[model samples]
Target: MDKNHPKSISLTLAFSLTALIFYLPANFFPFMSIELYGNRNTSTIWGGIVVLVESGSWPIALIVFLASIVIPFFKLAILFYLALTATNGKHLQLKLKLYNITEAIGRWSMLDIFLLAVLVAILKLGPWTTVEPQMGSLLFALVVIFTMVASASFDPNLLKENPNGKVS
Candidate 1:
């Protein structure tokens, strides 16, 4: 199928755009804020990782850092590259495999969101230590969801090029 196919191209473009837009704020904003003992503390996803590492939970910290920070950004970059190359009729077998892997990992990128949600739910101590959702969480969620949709919507056939170096 050609890249111009409405459903395939449009959905891929939409998801890629959304992922690009949301990724910025997701990394910049605080993911969670905690108010305890008349003091407020904030943590971005990375900040949480630092705290975890400092507290000697290195494994959990690394997992969260990689899954939440590294994976999402990597997935977005891969998706954008795939979409651009596909639209330009470039073909690469490895690109297709990378795209599929990105799609598979996209869902796991939501682990940070799930962790935040759980923290907020379980740590609501009514003025002791309250975890509030922050803008970063929202943006992060958007990034993950959009990437997932983009992967699903992308036309895998676009990766195949004709003899003339144009999409068939």
Candidate 2:
């Protein structure tokens, strides 16, 4: 991998772009739908957070917002910065640390999906409340996966290499 660090960066950029592309619909489109007492409620990721905030669960709302919305965008921005700085010969260590952070916190971004899955499984109470995942949830999962792959494929050492991002 060291011998081909530049190539890894290229692949990382590709995956990061793909993840960013998936991010839009994941936030705006309906993530899940719940049916209860013959009423249906559809919610996107941000809508869930808004509902939580409105319902007085401020802490949970903040957590979901941070994990789902803030962190993904942070990771994407950091990845973009890392890729740019790697070739521009600037902020090598800071960007490397940021890269480590993005890699470490990557999985936690899927918390919303995990919670929804658990709710769907346990809420099978005969027309009381049934939760079903929608297309946006799948896209969000893909975004997480793609970003994780991008982070791992990124060679932080390349940031300190030549201005062209070629390995020594």
Candidate 3:
């Protein structure tokens, strides 16, 4: 019964919860604001997806929806589940697979941030047009970061431990 194992589980849960808490505002608030010819447009995660869909970029919209919204949330849930069941001996294989998936999808959570950065860099037309990241962008980045740390802090080997904390 190594103490670090439980500590790792606690850390994972803490980070995952924190990420979940931040996720709401990230999607609801405006992440990007664009001023074009004195007309302003502010877009949240859902708003961006809707705009993409309306612009006939269904594939890109789907990818953004999944990468920015779905994947981070899914990864957080998987990490939370893994932490909760780390000491249970049952379903070790399933837990391991889920943990691996969480780790794999962790990088994708930053897709929104990357896209926002590129947009800001590209759309800096002085006095006519500009793209700026808003508070939601910062919150979204935090959610992604916290979830990544949560996934990384999770000890997959704990799935092999029995209820007594001994490997079975």
Candidate 4:
């Protein structure tokens, strides 16, 4: 890897770490709030999944859980790992494969965001009902964006570099 490659790797790791930082609040804080006839219902990502399971929508819940929670976390972890090990001169093929897979699956992480948008759009009623995204949605979106950027920023070539800064 060249000198600039190290900077690129560091940038990727930084973004991955930033996404991880955002991921916590994104899962715990309220993602959306619905107010109907003066009654308010607020839900975080996990809370929404539980509601879905309670309502016998386990499949949809699983989809949401995977897209929102599992996939994003996986992408971040993979990207962070790749960035950290880029110059270690080991597992080059495996690191490249992981990076490619992470990039390929990155779009699926936005599934939750699109679903929330559709829900908010479909459930918007007149004065009696309102659906608004909460802080968690914004934070979650950031996590997705940062992870995607981090994945994209990763240079597979780094995996070919030796620890002494020589390309294999």
User: For this target, which candidate reaches the highest TM-score against the unseen true structure?
Assistant: 3
User: What is each predicted model's overall lDDT from 0 to 1?
Assistant: 0.81, 0.84, 0.86, 0.87
- Pull out the clashing pairs in model 4: none
Task: Output the better candidate (2/3) by TM-score.
Answer: 3
lDDT of 2 by residue, 1-168 (tens): 356564877888899999999999889989999998879999998899999999999999999899888999999999877776676666667877887798789769778778888888888856677788998899999999998888888887676655556533
Each model's TM-score, in the order given?
0.84, 0.89, 0.92, 0.91
lDDT of 4 by residue, 40-159 (tens): 999999999999999999999999998988888888888888887777777778988898899789768788889989988888846688999999999999999998888878877777
Best by lDDT: 4
- Name the runs in model 1 displaced over 4 angstroms: 1-4, 87-91, 125-127, 160-168
lDDT of 4: 0.87
Q: Candidate 1 at 118: error in angstroms? A: 1.5
Global lDDT of model 3: 0.86
Q: Per-residue CA lDDT of candidate 1, range 1-168, in tens?
A: 453665786678788898889988888899889987779999888888899999999999999989887887788788778777675654577787887798678668778888888888877846588778899988888888888888889877777776887765
Backbone clash numbers for all candidates listed = 0, 0, 0, 0
Positional deviation of 12 in candidate 3, in angstroms? Answer: 0.3
lDDT of 2: 0.84
Which residue pairs clash in candidate 3? none
